[model samples]
Target: MRCLYCHAVIHEEMSWSDLLFKRIEDPFCGICKSGLLEIKKENSCSVCSGKMEGSGTCGDCLIWNEHQMYHDVLHSNRSLYEYNQLLKEMIKRFKYNGDYAVAGCFRKKIIEEVKKLPRQTLLVPVPVSEERLQTRGFNQTEALLVMAGLKFECLLTRKNEEVSQAKKLKHDRHSGENPFKAIQQLNGENILLMDDLYTTGTTIRRAAHILKEAGAGEVRSLTIGR
Candidate 1:
């Protein structure tokens, strides 16, 4: 195969990261990783851009008192992709197939999205329950963060294993009160919360509220897919 940036011939034997990292480490490869790839962004509503802003919930959110529910919250969030078939399959393979090797494929994209934020932003991966952690052996979100060269800390804990958020309706998922609890103080810091998928934004919002109450100066969210 050819290097995506340089068009130089690349060996198939080496994994994606090995090939990309080699090019990144090679000074002569002018078309190094930086310019070879970039994350894609789109213009849409800051909160849930599923439809036109004037159409429905967008306008309601503007005047809603829900904003007060989260302290130290700078802005609501956005996501990269709609939770369609392609994304669903990819996430399934990543989560259940033990395909950690493919994580680097997302590195460039994740870094691109993250670069739009402040450099001092600290990444916080949504925590999984102890039972889930023991079964999966690793949190895919954390792995993605490491692959993206971002610093992350597991600060929140899931109180219970509720129904899979993916299987529930958005309203049903967010209908329940926050289910996460912060065990540590964030202490007036900037944070970029991450998760594998954004089904209802319930988990992320709950985690964000916890951090804000702990004195986070600003809180934003990013997910692999929405």
Candidate 2:
């Protein structure tokens, strides 16, 4: 196989089996598999689906606070992929199909995004309710952070087990009634809020509000898909 990005010839080889019952070399190539790994590009806004012009924040995002009440404290947010067919499928499989291994693919993209920001920023992933955690065995946002080798704390909490926000319409997704509470104080801290996707600004806005109320110095968000 040839690498899509570099067009390198990937050599194949076999490895010994670990099981005691039997042993056989498998047909796989280390170089090709590594090369074929998907690379995520810094594309556009997940919330408004606008083009990102190296500002990290989109033009539509500049007016997000006008529609929402939390503008006074929230600083900005960023996402790596447009929430289109490819991203939707990737998120679905990561969330429901038990394809946890793919989290590393997003991890690479998100880490690149964070690197573009100033160093030493604290990462705060949106918290999943205990009920959902029990069923899913992991929070997809947290998994992405772990894979990215970023530092973060679980300071925010879901107020209740609300309906799957993913299925809601964009306007409904931002309705003010959905509440996120801060269980801990992050006073004077710069934070990077992380999530799986950004359909609307509601969830991140709620989180930014609570973080600012808790004395967070600056609040920005990062997600896998728009």
Candidate 3:
């Protein structure tokens, strides 16, 4: 077998607990799996789940709230992992290299978190531009949700002129018309926005604003990384 991220030969070895409980085999070897960083509660920002120095919200979230960058902003965001080098590489492979299978690495984790969303929460994915969608041949966030057995709606319709969000600079990302619009009214009580990563919170923030304008309430976000 091979490691999903590294593609190294993996000589499968089961732990004593796995043997005793007949646990489903893990695809990764110990070394590779150990590199998959899971964020601990104490280390993350209360609002954005980014790496924080102490208990309160991160400075970015504070500034965003103070300035109403995303009016009717999200209630909060929950992220599962830190955006470390390992995760960056994995995402690059999955997103840029067209290695779609790597998306399954987060399937179990995403499904587990989706179950915790509030009732009547509309699962809305961050849509890509027509240019990106055409090049990639798929919506990465939607694929992640489907593989996790979680359902989501492609509510936001992105403009044809825009490119991948990853390719934009920070300032450019914040200043644009956001390049997205809601296609249908979301009359749900809660909106749970989904994305693969949360960087400056720009993408989700823009989407959240559109969802609110379309009738979503108490918006929140869930991301694989922050």
* Per-candidate local distance difference test: 0.65, 0.68, 0.79
Total clashes in model 2, counting residue pairs 3 or more apart in sequence or in different chains: 1
* Residues 91-198, model 3: lDDT tens digits: 888887888888877876776777787776778888888788889888888878886667777788888764556788888777877677989886756888888899
Candidate 3 ranges beyond 4 A from true positions: 1-3, 7-27
* Model 2 alpha-carbon miss at residue 153, Å: 1.0
TM-score per candidate, in order? 0.73, 0.72, 0.86
Cα lDDT tens digits, model 2, 1-226, are 5432234555654344445444322212354334332323345443344465442556556677576466655565566655666556667777888777667655556766788776677888898878788878898989988876787888888855667776778777766474678878765888889988766677888888888888888788886666
Off by over 4 Å in 1: 1-42, 48-74
Query: Which candidate would rank higher by TM-score, 1 or 3?
Result: 3
* TM-score ranking from best candidate downward: 3, 1, 2
Sorting all predicted structures by lDDT, with the top scorer first, yields 3, 2, 1
Query: Whose lDDT is greatest here?
Result: 3
lDDT of 2: 0.68
Model 2: worst 10 consecutive residues (lDDT sum): 23-32
Residue 203 displacement in candidate 1 (angstroms): 1.3
For residue 202, what is the lDDT in candidate 2?
75
